[model samples]
Target: MDAEYQSFIKTLRAGHKPEFPADAKSIEYARLLDAQDKLSFLRANFNIPTRSPLRKRALDGTVPGAVKQLDISNGTKHVKGDAKEDAPSIYFVGNSLGAQPKCVRQYLNAQLETWASIGVNGHFTSLDNSPLTAWQDMAADCAQQSLDLVGAASASEVIYMNTLTVNLHLMMASFYRPTERRHKIIAEWKPFPSDSYAIASQLQWHGLSPSTSLVEIHPDPETMYISTEHILSVIDEHADSTALLLLPGIQYYTGQLFNIPLITSHARARGITVGWDLAHAVGNAELFLHAWDVDFAVWCTYKYLNAGPGAIAGAFVHERHHHHGHHHHSTPDPEKGVDVVGYLPRLAGWYGADKTTRFNMDKVFRPAEGAHGWQMSNPSVVDLACVRAALAVFGQTDMRALRDKAVVLTGYLEWLLMGLLKDNFGEPAFRIITPGNPLERGSHLSLLLRPGLLDRVSETLAAGGVVVDVRKPDVIRVAPVPMYCRFEDVWGFIEVLKTALEEAR
Candidate 1:
């Protein structure tokens, strides 16, 4: 880690977060920071949507980085200042959907070609000069590619399969085995709706009442900050009765990155299984699932991962959870037809079977070792291709580099936002709900605006070529994605927000 980042980490650990540098007040400073950024070259790999394309409801054969001219008068000459609508947008919504990677089109086409050319043979055949591996190995290939992103000890610990909610359901099926004494699940106050639904549904499936089984840890009333100490205290309170401790690695609404290691260790020490929903944190922040001794974790690939929306999600199962076998009867049972093989119980299917024996057509189940065993079906090759292309972009650089830049980029954003603390009439416009500490958050900032300003503010920002996520009831999420967003984008968003505030008022 850079010394500055190391210091920031220490400050975060010590609970002594200081404010961002006050000097980043000018657009020139943002440009200077951009010029000095080592990872700024990474922006070219992604297809950042421009203002015109973003507003377009129908596809016009237009793609980012491609010039699409229409409705030209007199020799199709370009007009100065009027071309602002065609300029690249300050897309600050990677928290919702990341900018597309340029390689996705090629990867998808290659997969489509393989399907068209070889049909069934494409599953096992590795084509020449191809960007993707065989379809059969696509999930593993993506998992191997993601080892560093999620910090797994081995590729086997990570598996790319269904969407995040499905993975969570599968993980709970295996890890959320509640006994009479420990039927409760400890969760943060607010989880993404999918997670809350999954957790609650799982409890219902297990013949347990959600009211009695679900224990939620509420955050601070003022800041919406869920501290590590508070989480640990909640775990302590329900230690014996809690079967699972599930929390988001980063809160989706607040963008508050949790202390995963500390929280995981604390819960696991009390005989509670730890699971993290890294939907926001996986690509936005650093993770160490294996090292943290996390029992399991789940994440989607769309946010900060540059994969298309509803892209294949991934999960991590500790090596200890990967059971090649536990205990099995040598003889086939007369009732069951095949010899029973003992392993971690999951909602298994043919895809989870070992590749060697997967097509045996026998009734016997031989689960694949590691997280892959949790898979219920063969993944979509199309989804895998998109994931592969996205991961390929990440393969060019390590998480440390991305995170290092994000820390600075987000700090610059905060520093600038701080200058706009109040309007010209001297009233506070909005309050940032995300933590100020770099180590305690990710690339995005969540601003809780004053009442009645969200819709108008959102409209003004859209008109000004600044794309952001406005979570209704007055919050705007601006995420300057480290992979494609520039420091200038951050500066431009603040400038647009300032204007929007003026107009909204």
Candidate 2:
């Protein structure tokens, strides 16, 4: 084993936290925490962007706050400086896009080689001379790696296929069946826009007005966090009319991790099918779709899963839903021109047909088992290759271990941010909108800045080599991923943020 790997194993055996003073904001204290970190070595497995085009001019002796004119002589170029090229940027934007894994290139190259040598034949053949299945089963292979992360019972319960919004629409097509009595769809007040759009459209498709058919549960005005009681109350209030309940596993803007199992169970008991948009929670929070009896769920891989931008996303359907009408096959209703008496009516494609008859060129659509049945088309090989590489890293360690580290790492960040407020400003420059309780949130922290200061503060942090994302008027979201981020990165970010806040003032 390599020295770094050995050191990581040793640290894991010794437990994660160090005996550093909780209130200490020194670099030495951060280094002490990093030394005892079990997931620190995983940082080397990723390629962190060391320098940004935005920061190059600053490094070339340009004034700190001065905006340099871009010399677009040769399509924009930066003059190299003596800046430390090996130092990684303090990347706290994993909630948006995760840092690329170093192995993705290797994985992509292998697929490219296969495509070059075998062409169309590569679809049914293995190129690496391995005993694994062919490229035809690539989506299944990718889903296998993610089963544990989402707490799925079997591989068939999950399949990586379309993007998050696309999958949300697809799942809603089948799960959001409405009748006269149960026509309402319940969701959070400010879900991710895509989810809100899809849900509203689905209701409109059913010929119902969103104003009456769609129910939204808002956060407590004072706490800015949605209480479980509030969500439960909404479900109960609409129980008689509710046909479906769609919610995010984690609220994107506030960084709130909802109690999914509790909410799912409550909705299911009320005869309402529950589905989750897990784009923010899939890799960041521990999930149990099958155990929770969640009707369906969707998530993207680019954020916490470390796949490239717009990479293939994932979906889950309970096994019980899979065999609902298995013994009975659908026949077209000659009168209405649709199959009215079958399992869940879905937007079907050839790719979702049973494997045995998939290539048979039959007129009848015999759906495949489980979540695989929801695939509308063959997955993009390049996208699946990226997912494969990311999941390979996930296979090295389980989500349980990662979550354990996350609580400590994120807790440390919360601690440092609070201390920075107390020590520097002696007043609130910003308040963390995410729940203060560790169990109520994930890795991301949403800082709600004082009115009109969000953009300026975010820009200052970016100029100072800290990468975080700002959401509209006043929120800045920072997520320190456990796979690649270190305690030192957290410490450096806090220091840079202090300077940024001062500059903003």
Task: Give the winner by lDDT.
Answer: 1
Query: Which residues of candidate 1, in runs, are more than 4 Å off?
Result: 1-23, 67-82, 326-341, 422-425
Residue lDDT tens for model 1, 1-505: 2455456434544445535455566778678777777788898888788887787775445575745544434454332334776689998998899999989989998999999999999999999989999999999999999988999999999999999999999889888888788889998888999889998999999899889999999999999998889888999999988889999998999999999999999888998889999999988888888899999999999998978999999999998777545354454332222234567667889998888888897587778888988877978999999999999999999998888778777877887787788435577889999998778999899999999999999999999999889899999998998888998888888888889998998
Give the residue spans of candidate 2 off by over 4 A.
1-23, 53-86, 129-133, 324-342
lDDT of 2 by residue, 13-113 (tens): 34442332554588886777778777788887787766443344433432221246334354444444445643578888889998888778778878888
Q: Residue 100 deviation, candidate 1, in Å?
A: 0.6
For residue 33, give model 2's deviation from the true position in Å: 1.3
- The window of 10 residues in a row where model 1 has the poorest summed lDDT is 331-340
Model 2 lowest lDDT segment of ten: 57-66
Error of 1 at 494 (Å): 1.0
Cα-lDDT of candidate 2: 0.82
